[model samples]
Target: MRLSTVILPFRRWHDGGADQWRRAEELGFHTAYTYDHLSWRSFRDGPWFGAIPTLTAAAGITRKLRLGTLVTSPNFRHPVTLAKELITLDDVSGGRVTLGIGAGGTGFDATALRRPEEEAWTPRERADRFGEFVPLLDRLLSQDTVTYEGTFYSAGGAQNVPGCVQRPRIPFAVAATGPRGLRLAARHGQAWVTTGDPKLFETGTPQQSWEAIRAQTEKLAKACADVGREGDGPERILLTGFTPDRPLESFEAFVDFAGRHAELGFDELVLHAPIPDSPFAADQRVFERIATEGVAALGG
Candidate 1:
């Protein structure tokens, strides 16, 4: 299985930020992704940079490291504008950009744009909007000119002149677990991502978390079948850290962690790059060792 890392956008490009991207490339990570949010939880008051710009900058600095968002959502984005930015980013990266996208959560981002008096989107509404969002995005990225009118978004002959460097736009790594979202992923995703089950994050054991991921992957397979997709559908990705597993505690630990998930049909595994003082905190040394040696340990 391929190993990757999620580098949070909490540092400025010039202020020791570029180093992380450079180091990720040096460490031989398959891809380096960042959270695409205006402001994420906990890091809300801290120095959080924009995803596209950070990725654009990383693309310039790193030659082989693939760059992308852990997820960009429709919560505060429109397909037309997002597609435009992604097109430019793909060109800048020389087609090494994967747009990890999702239906978005009801966290700070859900209400960041709305007034206190205005209510946030209900669960059903969010799902309904996402249903419109992904396909519209798929079209906007693939076609040169699109004029789409949907319930949550409308594109008025939006022009994407030369289109993306990756042929049919950049690859999309869709993060989803629900039925509609899974169906959307099955249809549109080049890769499907999961952080296991959020419900299992704080309360469930590691074995339970693995089982939850197994079930979700089965659901994704069923979704792909529903869409008439033959063979293994989208690439499976399991983003580590959120689940109650200490994958990065040691190199051996990561090997064990990766071995189990790889058996669950995951094509790639993503670890959060060490953050100094947070839930994602880990020994930087161990992390680097895992990046360099852990994957090979799982093999002969």
Candidate 2:
């Protein structure tokens, strides 16, 4: 299984941001991702680091680690502009970039964007709009002229000049939590990244949370099959957040749980360390353990 690391963009740890990325490469992480939020839900930090610039910085620092947004909100930027920026990053990274995106989720600074709370659509509506946006993005990234007409957005014969440096197309992933979103990921994304406290689901005690994730993965697989797309086949199921207090048993259960999903064809499993204010804090020890024993046990 391939493993990656997720980092928050807004913090002092990110101040030496490019150097931090180089450290992740040295730590043997295959990819490094950053969140694209103006402000986090529960904490305030230094000035928000815009996603594109930080990713570009990551590109300059790491030669092999794939760089990307953990999940950028579509509501925050126009699809055409995002496509261009992604292509530019891909070129700078020598085609080592993946675009992970989603409709805006909670803690989103809608007011900061000057979008009223009521104007924010329901998850269903956001999913519908995202459906329209993805195909347009795919076209634009592929250097095709976009002539799309949709309720949320419309464009007329706008050509995306200087296509992505990545051959064929840059890989696109989706961070999904709901059924509609999962279906969208199965159809549109090359991979899906799931975020949650895995301990809530991994303990053998039959919890609703664990059942929900299993059901969601089953539904996602079916959705892919319905659309004639491969679902969680290989390098598709990128599960994040599987940390526990103890290293051995916790890591064992974590690998066991992921292996169950792998039996169902779920592929990549990325364990995210808890976000910390400082990069070398106590929480980082968990990542160190995973980099050593946890990865070896899971065959990462």
Candidate 3:
């Protein structure tokens, strides 16, 4: 299992922000991702930087580490604008960028820009929008000029000159568990992402979480089969921290945790970088040790 990490966008660049990304590369992480939010939960009141800018800066400092958002959604983004930014970011990173995208949840992002009279999108509406969003974003990134119209979004002769540094655009790591979302991932993703089932987070056992993910992979395989890509689906990525398993408690724990997920067919495992005084908080030393030694232990 390849090891990766998510570094929450809670720090300012001048105040040791760049150092964390630089250190991520030094520690040999495959990719260092961040939350793509205007402001995330709990950290809403705290400093949260823009994902594109943070990634551009990280690209400037790191030579080999891949950079990406854990998942950017259509919550507050238009496909045209987001595609332009991603193309620039891909060039900045020298093609070392991945776009982990999802159909956003009903968080502050859902209503952050809405007027008082405007209601947030319902689950059905969110799903409908995502179905349109991903395909259009795909076209906008891969094609030179796109002119299309849809219920939730549109493009009017939008132009992306010279396109992405990564041919056919940067790799998309689509985050999904639902059938329609999985279908999208199977059709368009270079990687499929999951955090297990959030419903099981509170009361479910770790064994149950593993089973849930196993079921998800099965669904993904079925989705790929439907699209005539059976046995050659996107790479599977499990973003840890939402589930009950505490993989980073120690090097041994991470190895065991990663090994089990590997058995479930996950190609990569992502742990959150240690955060102080938060739910994601963990011992920094342990996190570093895992980054340095955990992958070798897992024979990554």
Inter-residue clash pairs, candidate 1: none
* Ten residues in sequence with the least summed lDDT for candidate 2: 240-249
**Residue 270, candidate 1: alpha-carbon lDDT:** 95
lDDT against the true structure, per candidate, is 0.92, 0.67, 0.92
Q: Report model 2's TM-score to 2 decimal places.
A: 0.83
Task: Summarize candidate 2's per-residue lDDT along 223-283 as a digit string, tens digits.
Answer: 7787778524314645454322222235565566666555544566565545554321335
**lDDT (Cα, 0-100) at 19 in candidate 1:** 97
What is the per-residue lDDT of model 1 for residues 1-300, given as tens digits with 9 covering 90 to 100?
Answer: 899999998888888899999999999999999999989888888888899999999999999999999899989999999999999999999999999999888888899899999888988898899999999999999999999888779999999988999987788899999999999999999999999988988899999999999999999999999999888999999889889899988888888899999899899999999998898999999999999997789882
Model 1 RMSD in Å is 0.9
In candidate 2, list every pair of residues with a backbone clash: none
Cα-lDDT of candidate 3: 0.92
